[model samples]
Target: MKKMFNYYSDKYLASWIIKFLDLIVVFVGFVLASLLRFNFEVAGMSLSKLLEQSLITCAVYLVIFSLSKTSDLVMRHTSFTDIHGIFKAVVFSLAILIGMDVFLYEGMDYTGVFLIPKSILIIQALLVMLGISGYRLAAKSIYATFLNSSSALKSNVLIVGADVSSLMTKSTLLNSSKHSIRVIGHVDNHPKLQGKKLDGSPVFQLDNVINSSFLKEKGIDEIIISDATLGPAQKRAVIDSALQYNIKVREVPPHEKWVNGELTENQIKPVRIEDLLGRSEIKLDSINIQNELQGKTVLVTGGAGSIGSEIVRQALFFKPKKVIALDQGETPCYELGNTLKKLPEDIAAKCEIVIADITHFRRMQQIFSKYKPDLVFHAAAYKHVPLMENNASEAVETNVFGTKNIADLALRYKVQKFVMVSTDKAINPTNVMGASKRVAEIYVQALNSQQNSTHYIVTRFGNVLGSNGSVIPLFQKQIEKGGPITITHKDITRYFMTISEACNLVLEAGSIGNGGEIFVFDMGESVKILDLAKKMIQLSGLQEGKDIDIEFVGLRPGEKLYEELLAVEENTLSTHHPKIMRAQIQPVVSDEVKVLMDRLHEKVLHGDDEGVVGGLKQLVPEYISKNSVYSRLDKKSSQAYA
Candidate 1:
């Protein structure tokens, strides 16, 4: 029977039937009002006059209802907006009817008999509104109750907030026929709301005593957090407590993510490890960044990669005159172009994608000559530690020569600012990738010393959470496969930040850097790889030792147990921004740097792997190889210097 009702309710015939029923209800309300006004004496009122008044009332209501389209709304999903529509239609229809009665009576009165008394008309309007609104509200209530009570596989839920968003979330869940989760109660931090009731559900204050026993007593199978006001630490605490009880935990995104200004059950998602990192939101100087980028032709290399693509997105926010995203990857660069094409017409008109390698000097020179970009963000480089260890020449060619190409062209084109993205691995480097980046840093710093129009800046930070080779995505894939998760070492750790945060700070650093300054971001704290793996397994609702196995493979070539942000010889000075600091290192002589780079470039071009490693050691004195084939060169360099 319910299925049949649902099927017919969606047909066009149902809408017309509802409209016809509404007219009959309005007509009856008018006649009933007249009977009541006459003290239940039908003889006191002329039956013909009452019938004529009923027709007029029904006609007016039909016109007004059509205009408001109140009958077009589904009865089962009716809300306050629908009720408001019905009220407006009824009041407007009666107001016009009263005006017509007064106008005709004053102008043309044949027998001096009134169509409807003013008091009767007012009573009729109220009756019509209630008749229409009450039925819809009752239908919605019945449907929600049926959905909640009829399900046999329902899971008891506890909401973590008692505010407006939580209320909406509960309503959405209750109204959804496909969902079987029943909200049992609310948990809030406010003492005043401890014993209060939200829609007849009791609210309890959260305390430290919450545990598996408390959850079991409440019969809670899941906890849904819908409060954006709670800090990360508080949310983490709730998640941790819920996880201990083996109860599923989910969270709603910020209000801005709601579709069409309405929350849906699908928007609730499981909590992620990034939420537990406890990093505060970054505050950027938008006006300063806009002033530096607006109406300027900007270029971002590696713009198809993670950090580079984010830099492109941020640059578009500043309304640059033209943003040229240059990357060597054909597929990703094409995808970036498609993404930009879907942006607002005005914003998309200002973006251009180029598939060109940064190592090709002639191609880069052409780009610089044609566009003459006013600002350049250099992010192209080979970054895999183990991969670069075997192919050291490729690392030098891309990280070193690629950066040098862009920096030189920026000088020749007289660009205003040049920002090179570096890594924390560049500090006291132990890997070929890091050493190559450090060498590029030295050259850019040395170039800044020469009289030039470009203000060269370098922003260095640690590992980004979901970048190309980051461990988070790898762990996620392994967990999905339900197999052994591999770790390089149990004690390995690295500083982490979101890609968005890192890019925002990079732009901030670019705006504030004068010249020859390496800006290091405050990457909150280093996370243990072993602990991260365990938390990931827990998040996936699997046991570490039983459901999944974590195998510790010894450290890879050129890999270290820890990463550094600053070298021993480099000291940092506080900057205007809280999260950013300036690294002050001994200046490199430009003449000496030029001679060494030329020699290193020759070796790299000739494919002399040994000579390239030898030149890298000579350039960066602190570039000691660790568990790599290049370790032999460290001994050779020490002996040569001695």
Candidate 2:
């Protein structure tokens, strides 16, 4: 019973108080009008006439206020909305008050020679409206204070880079009663702001804050770098500092979000794993994008996989006529289909899912004929290095033969474009996977050179972080199991990127490629595998050496110590997208190449693993089998062949 009374008293009684303030406004307005008509004198010329005019003004003000519903405007949060409501209130009040004055003077008060003019009524109404609006404005501030105090929430923030966005971030934090965050201080790269004040918080230099022994002693919680203009390298350095300090760091969304006016507190996210890779963001050309994919029927071969699914998401955003997604995996396909179903109705309708293998040439041909797709993204391939070493024939059959089947069908269907997803392993191959990939790259490039239509382009890059069989998720699972995190080798390093970033580069590649061009993404610096494991453990808030033990096993079969983005012979030519480059590679082909490839495919079909390896080595002379028991070509040939 007591709790119910408190609820009613707090809400219902407070509402009545606000309504009384509105009534006081109406009464005060008429009194001020009467005093103004009497030239500021206390005594009025005719008390009865003044009373009658004041009552009529009060009645008019009440009717307008009720119609405008001005008393119910207390629930607005932002000042902009309040200002809008105030404008409406003033306009409605003046309209009704002036209408009442004209009615009384022209229709009923003609006998009086000393009646009030309508112009004085306008001035008095304006004064009373300003007074009431001012009171409501003050009440809004008081209400915000009450709400903030009741919540007892504050976020502990340490801002980096004292830029304009930093100040805005501070203001947003202070204005919110929703989150429990507080700005403890600011950390800037520039030393000039060391002792400066921002929103009543002390500013400290970043070097002093992180390296100083006393900085962390002050209980500085989270750090935010609000400067969007910082270059990739600078941003990387700041993020590294945050990781070192074990404090979460935040960054703004990309320019696309900013230009769309999507600036908000929630849009700001913690610096992700990709930011540490230190790669520059890709810039896409809108005109080329629209010309290539908008409203066009397209097909993605490995559609349920990481890269393929991202392509489907991005393609649907462009409002394609239809997007055909083909994959062999059941679970991933079902998951992707489910996610697509949850998208907006228009986007959901654009996606079509098909479960099929690319190795079956007949099935791929039928799909092409059925959909008549304008473009195709070929991403299905066997990529695990050590696993491929054990099963070399399957790797060769899928990576080499699968690519040939897709290319042939694209030509048969006269598809406008065919993009083959290639890898850095193809460059100066030393493993079975790399050898097969190199062979596939040669086949596509050679096909593009000879073919008149169906422009064939290749996009090649190194490892992505969370792809199938990636080491990151493996390490995370091992850590969660409360034991050792395994690493193949302490010295091994590989170039890494996020799946989203890689797919965007692929899209940009497709937009810029003409024909027979190999597109290479600018992968950032290679990360040491051992260091990556330690950081992951630290991010989990566990001591690396004590709580979680890291085990360094010897290098696996066919694993390279360092992955390269380009072959020793290939050079890069800059394209319109800074992060994408056109590889200056020579396409190797001969008149008898088709017969040789056909014979090789037959060997793969007949389970002749030895013959397939021999033919693959002969086709791509750069293929050097390393750390494997498989047969290598007797003669060492320096010339790179098709």
lDDT of each: 0.87, 0.75
| Per-residue accuracy of model 2 over 1-642 as CA lDDT, tens digit each | 444433532452244465567667766776776677677887645667766766666666667666666666443233444456656766776676666566767777654523456765776677666777777756555554554455544446777767766775665554454564667887776767779887688887766765555335766556777777767777766666656767667776653565333245676676655566646666667567767898799899899998899988988887679999999999999999899988998888889999999899889888988999999998888888889888777998889998889888899889999998899888888788998988888888888888779898999998887888888888878988986998878898988988888888888789788888999988867789888887777656577778989888877777778888888888999988878888898657645567668777877877776667767777776677766665344354422222
The global Cα lDDT (0 to 1) of model 2 is 0.75
Inter-residue clash pairs, candidate 1? none
| Model 1: residue 159 alpha-carbon error in angstroms | 2.1
TM-score of each: 0.88, 0.73
Cα misplacement distance, residue 637 of candidate 1 (Å): 3.3
Question: Where in model 1 is the C-alpha error above 4 Å?
Answer: 1-13, 16-43, 46-52, 59-74, 79-125, 190-192, 206-217, 545-547, 638-642
RMSD of each: 3.6, 6.4
Evaluated at residue 429, the lDDT of candidate 1 is 92
Which residue pairs collide, candidate 2? 154-180, 154-181, 155-180, 155-181, 155-182, 156-182
> Residue 283 in candidate 2 has what lDDT?
62
Candidate 1 lDDT tens digits, 1-642: 656645654544377778998988898888878877888898677788788778878888999999888789667777655787788888898899888778777667623444467888998898888877877777778777766655668989898889988888887777776776778898888988878999889897776325336777887888888888887778878877877777788888788998766787789888888877657789999999999999999999999998998899889989899999999999989888888877888888888899999999999999999999999999988999999999989999999999999999999999999999999999989999999999999999999999668899999999998899889999999999996999999999999999999999999999999888999999987999998888888878888889999999999999999999999988999998999999989988999899889989998988887788788888898999999998988776443421
After best superposition, candidate 2 residue 64: deviation in angstroms?
8.8
Give the total clashing residue pairs for model 2: 6
Q: Candidate 1: what lDDT? A: 0.87
